[model samples]
Target: MHPRLKAVSFAVATLLAGAASAQSATHIAVTDAPDAQSATADAPASTALSRVTVQGARVRELPISSGALGARTDLETPFSTRQVTAEDLDARQVKSLGKIFANDASVMSLGDTFSFNAYSINVRGIPLDDYNGYKINGLPFFMTTVELPVESFESVQLLKGSSGFMYGFGAPGGIINFVTKKPTDKTLFSADLGYRSDGVFSEHIDAGGRVGDDRRFGYRLNLTHEQGDTYNGANVQRNSGSLGLDARLTSALTWTADAIYQSRRVKGGVQDFFLDDFNGDTLPKAPSGRKNLGAAYDNTFFNSNVFFVSSGLRWQIDPNWSAKVDVSRSQDRRRYSGQWMGLLNGAGDYTVYLNKAQGAATYEQAQALVEGEFTAAGLRHQVTLGLAWQGLNKQTVPKSLYTPIGQENLYAPITPLSWNGSYDDSLQYHNYHSAQKAVFASDTVQFSEQWSALLGLRYSDYDQTSFNTAGTVTNQYHKTPVTPTVALMFRARPDTLLYASYVESLEQGSTVGQTYVNKDEVLAPLKSRQYEIGAKHEGRDWGATAALFEIDRGAEYANAQNVYVSNGQIRLRGAELNGYWNLPAGLRLTGSAAWTAGKYRETDAELVGHRLEGIPKWQGSIGASQKIPGVEGLSANAELHYYARFDADSANKYKLPGYSTVNLGVSYETQIAAHPVTLRAGVDNVFNRNYWGFLQSGYTFVGAPRTLGVNAKIEL
Candidate 1:
């Protein structure tokens, strides 16, 4: 066994032993939007041992939005769910979505440091692109090829597994709900400044308040700017701003609006290297982590502007029933310019292609639902019936040119070659539109105090059309897909629950990834299914979850005869164990481990039983934090992440090395000039270990090297 794995095993064993032998400890259920430093408060002395229960397990729930299903506690939901709170963001100094989920065993980051505006992740061995994996308060919104404006969000909730019954068509990975910061009755103001080892500087301002004495008018505004060198030694600058407003028209109705703008520019950015670029089948040694191998003239520019408005009317017609209607529309204009460079050989010779494009996309969406409490056959039940509609219209024009940047050694790079300004006019304008309408119903039946069941079904109608540059319809599709979910839960103990679920999800045909012979052709919609069994335990200061799951997704690939077809499937089976504990004193621990096996089950002979590329069979992470006994407002934390070796190609011709990394952080809270202030600093990859970062898409990039960052926030 590897020395690192043996060490991890020993540590885990010690932790388990400690958890079992420790004396009584204080436990606090995590709440929504908790005060930043509440967790560090000293625990009160008590003679009796107290049982810890999850906040959601109780009748009173946190004041937060719960996607399409409305507000419900974690225990009320019939799926695996997790929330990343605002406090977590500040404590970790999380600047990117990738860093936010780094410790999560179920998620894997695919975007490298220089991916500038792009953000992608794989959930439970299933990859979800920026477009269809995100939501803003239950309304489907596309991140496209841009980073999410995480500063404007109050909290992020992840519903793991299939969510087709709640969301329309999407990957089975899961649903990510980004709840925006809402207008508060109390005045709020905050400012933050940050610096990174790469010479990056960041400034952010957030302010929100109720303007009118009646407190019916509220507004929240945020502005952020970041500029400097990235981990890959690439130059980047980003500017973004957002304004959110809310007005209460009546006791039962409310209106909300938001405007967001972002502009980013990147120079000398680099992406993952393809296996074909190397000299031999075996993977070559990676370049220096700090090396920027791209041409000096290579640049990428991205700009986006969005305007959105939404209104909701909630009526409590009677004591046992309530109805809500939500309507929203959004318009987004996006522009991109720059050349993409990819290494063509180990010698650092690269192929550069200029890609300039302008695009616009519009989304109109509405949803209505009625929730009622009733008794059926002596069993208490909560039922929800909802209807939703969404329409998308997109148009894009490509002014592209291709060129080659001459060879340059990775160890000693040279200046980029100049372009001749020649262009490619072969491609035409691309336009596409899609509409999705669905009706869904769910019932949570309490058979007894110890047993409950949840059942849901959704009927979706999706239509899409493609148009040529001349405005002629080139292709059209009309599809109706039905998805269903059923789950059963039993309370093994007052603080423990056992559950089993079976669910199905739907995904529209992919218009990206031209791996097939027929490139750029949209495939058919896909249907996927999942079966999972899990157990959850919540205590006063600790919680744990374990789950076993199997998933199958429809796939498409070229056959033996080189014919592109959609008669293929992929299967994944996995198990996960995750938990957190706040031990006696001010010590805290968090850990997670996952193992999965994925393969092409139904495909050509060469592909059958082959392991999925970029998916490690074993992964785990452990993190801990401790408060300084001598310092009242000081804490320190450390984390370790591990990944097993995996192949970089479906054919198993190239293998990437496994790696492990460590991170350390420190935070101090104090009062500065009568204002609460927090200072935080952290360093990742402390050992400066070099490793290969493999993506499910068969791309590879060098992992980040040792880097340091610090940030300070003051409540004004």
Candidate 2:
């Protein structure tokens, strides 16, 4: 066994032993009391102990939204999905999307918190589309360089496969949906104070309740502010606010509205390293992750703002029929002025370059759906019919200014040159527009008590246009496609489900980055197909799932000429296993493992069968939480993540070494003056391991350093 694994095992064993001994001592003291008076004196302690129960068991049963298909539990859904509730977010001290999915083997980080202002990930070895892969309450939103406030959401759901039939057009990678917090039946109010490593501090407030004599009006409000220096020698400030309102117009109809606004600013942001100019045969060793190689005079920063508004209505037409209609609009704006370093040789000598640009994307969507059940041909059928329309408008400056600045050495660095450039934001023009209209339907037929089949189809008309600053059309694309999905499910037992599904999707293509030779070029849309087989088992004290999946789609990459093009087909096959167990003696365990094999086909001879870049063949995580036997509301939790080595480039010439990281945390819950309070503290990357975290588009980023976080929450 590996030395690190052995050490971790020994530590867990020691902790369990100590907890058992403590519980034994408490039992002896209580039984050997001098008199009845002594037992009465310990009544408060007993009460506190009773209040502490197992945590995280309720997460598995949370209902998940399936777009127009309606809501369903994990066991009822034919696809693999996961939900992270607000409680899980607080307990894990999550600050970014990457942190929220740290323990998920099916998701891998493309950019960490410190590497970029916005977070990105690869699901099933494919990167999600920034414009189509993210949704808020089943509506589309642009997510490039935008990070929403986590406190404003009640839960986040992840669907792990193609969703063409569910949503009109999207990437085959997956979908991430953010569910907003709504007014509650009982009055709720809470305040939180938090501190992160390097002097970052935050304060947040949340409140929700109903109003009026009839209790027909409801409202939920959230406000947050955070500002401080970051681990990478950068200063960041953020402010955000959100409100949700609902009105019960009649006995069976409800109207809901939500609005959100956030502003994020950063100074002295981290610089990404570009290896396009490197002449060495092998990559250089990574430096200390905490080292600040950027210049003080660089004056690099990013200013981002996001605004969203949505309104919807839900009507119960009858006892077994329901209808919903929703419309939403959102805008994401960002201004970036930063430096990217270009490596010159193996010695790490590099030249700094500056870039300044501003851009914004506006998205509008409307959807209507109806769901009902009926009996047809001696079989019970559940049906859903929906229509959806969505459009996007992208605007940007005519050109981004790029210039070479100064030079520096990696091992022996010198001071940076002063900033000598400026940005012009006056002339912004529309660069791209896209629209989609679709009608979709699905039927689930139950042939017997234990057998069912689902058939779904969607027909869509998609239009895309790209224009130059002069309003001249540069590119245009139009297509009409029909996507379909079919699934068969069987109930092996009362609590076990086995299913097989086939799905097809139409995915939006990629846009060439500014660094590429052919900048501002938009590729044509691609078609993708997926096949999956899985089994799920739900028990009183445990839940488990296993799945095997394969995906095939058109591949695009930067060739030797530094031009981005689509010339081949990419195929990915993988297997995943996940489970959780609520063990005896206040111990809980969770684990997941994934193995993926990827290859390129029908491409250049030299690139045939080459492995995909930035994808690990094996990844997994294990976590354990143990409650203190004699102490009430106190628990210690630890998690370990492992990633196997994989190729860093399409040529398969360089390989990144495998690495592992560990995170540890503890929390205590108690009452102060009749109010409930909880305190938590945690440290990530406990060993301070230094390694490369991501490699994409010829840019490589280093992993984050060890960091600490402490938080306190009080309920009133």
Task: Point to the candidate with the largest lDDT.
Answer: 2
Candidate 2 lDDT: 0.75
- Please report, as a residue range, the 10-residue window in candidate 1 with the lowest summed lDDT: 41-50
The deviation in Å at residue 335 for candidate 1 is: 3.8
- For all predicted structures, in order, the TM-scores are 0.88, 0.91
Q: Which pairs in model 1 have colliding backbones?
A: 27-540, 27-541, 28-540, 52-539, 52-540
On residues 250-277, what C-alpha lDDT tens digit does candidate 1 reach at each position?
A: 6655666666666666666655554434
Predictions in order: lDDT? 0.67, 0.75
